[model samples]
Target: MKLRKWAMGLLAAGLLTAGLSAGSPREAYAESKQIEVSFSPVHFIFGGEELDPPEGQRAFLYKDSTYVPLRFASYALGKAVDWDPDTYTVTVREPKAEEKVSIDAYIEERKAGDRPILPVDASALQPITIDAYFEKVNYVFGKRTVQPPAELPGIIIDGSLYVPLRFVSESAGNKLEWDGETYAITGVSTAEGAKPYDEIVLEAEQAFQELVSGFTSEFYVLKSEYDGADDAGREEVLLQGARKLLEGQETFRSEILETLKAKLKAGNYYEGAVDQLAAQFEDKKQGVINLVTLFTGKDLTPYLEKAEKELEGK
Candidate 1:
């Protein structure tokens, strides 16, 4: 779907500002009670326009420590950022569309690197070494310098990582403008783009249907297994859950079919719809598996019957 007119304007402005920062490596970092580190943002030009931010964009601060949502920044900037719970490192990268980037890239780069000059005041805070943090969270940051143990800070808030907004915007060939009054950051790409709305709606419908069907098949399998079991109460509870799934499936099916009919009447081609549906189906397969596991207390094999039957008809 094409971004709304206002959103496009914001993106364009954001990209232009981002492009100007290409000369020098901008220092994007967060100040926390424990430590401070430097980093850069990933940039990209997608379909000749910058992509929008990912969901859940927020900023936070605690005990004078600032926390920025890394996912939104990375997703919006078209960069790859991953957290390793095993190590407390935040991996940030400028990933190409076709490249297979991994979270380990940051750690490898940093390990083969040098320690950075630590700030004087930051030296007094409790030492929360990145290596120690990584051991706690299984995550690592990209190449950067760190101070010695004596100058380290204590208690790192590894939950929310921060970055300079300008770094991400400029790197993506866009501009970032902050509205002080509204506290909103507006990112403007350099160009315009669009996706078919009807197509998206149709695809969403198909995905909803498939998810329902999968759940239904899994529900039946569990029901069959528990049919002659001695735990009558448990069986009743399972049956109720199955009924809910069935009702949900019917509702989802009706919604999708109605939406498709409407789009078809409006002269929308089914190609986009089909493409979206296929994508969604592929994406949601894991989610379906997770759900089945939760309720069935078994593997996903139980849900295969309904999906197989549906596919055969297709």
Candidate 2:
């Protein structure tokens, strides 16, 4: 690899390119002359939770920039971090819906390793590799592009890439702060906070209660009108109430149930949480159906089914 070009890439765009020496990489590059680096014990807090670095990896000081393990940092921010050995490319992006399980597994799998660091001395310069570019995925634009960070290039120590901590955290929309005395880095994620399961269930119950109260009030008015009307006019009054109930059912299905489902999916909710919420939604819908039957003195099962089918087609 062209060392000058790679060094320039890191300075401007945070891309670190490097050349791999022949034979076993660690052994072959041990004798190369480079800059001196030091290791410091740095603490990391992400999204209100403390994150411990994997064994045998750490944040180190290089020319005043705090360099963190690239994969670990990206994963802490809830992004999918990947390393391609064949192409020597690192990719960072939003995890796909289907990748949630695999990502969790990967995190657990990376908790252990042994990468011995060379002792700091006059002749020791940390082996730096400037031979990788980051490909950032943007799901909103539906594009996969190689977009380097706008600051310093990353360094490769042992087998891992170390990137500037501030750049990674800010790029992920996190508020980062450092404590000089304690040697700690803390960050707050800007992603939407997950709604509690109880809160979601309570909201659903309240909305369903309101719908029931409004429908009952409208039904009473219709009953009063029917009682005063001639037999020919009474039929129309009952039909109006039935139409209103069916419309209310559709709104409850789309607005309340579906909206809740979307919110649950967006957050880091578990599968059991979604299933429980779904059960409550079904209970609420059935209660509405029963209320409609009692008020109109006619079963609305067929009408509700037909309306749902029409909605699905649309």
Best by lDDT: 2
State each candidate's clash count.
45, 7
TM-score of each: 0.25, 0.39
Report the lDDT tens digits of candidate 1 across residue range 6-43. Answer: 43333324322322111221222223233333211222
Instruction: Give the TM-score comparing model 1 with the true structure, all chains together.
Output: 0.25
Clashes of 2: 7
Worst 10 residues of 1 by lDDT: 131-140
Instruction: Note each model's CA RMSD in angstroms.
Output: 19.1, 17.2
Model 1 stretches with alpha carbons more than 4 Å out = 1-230, 278-289, 299-314
TM-score of 2: 0.39
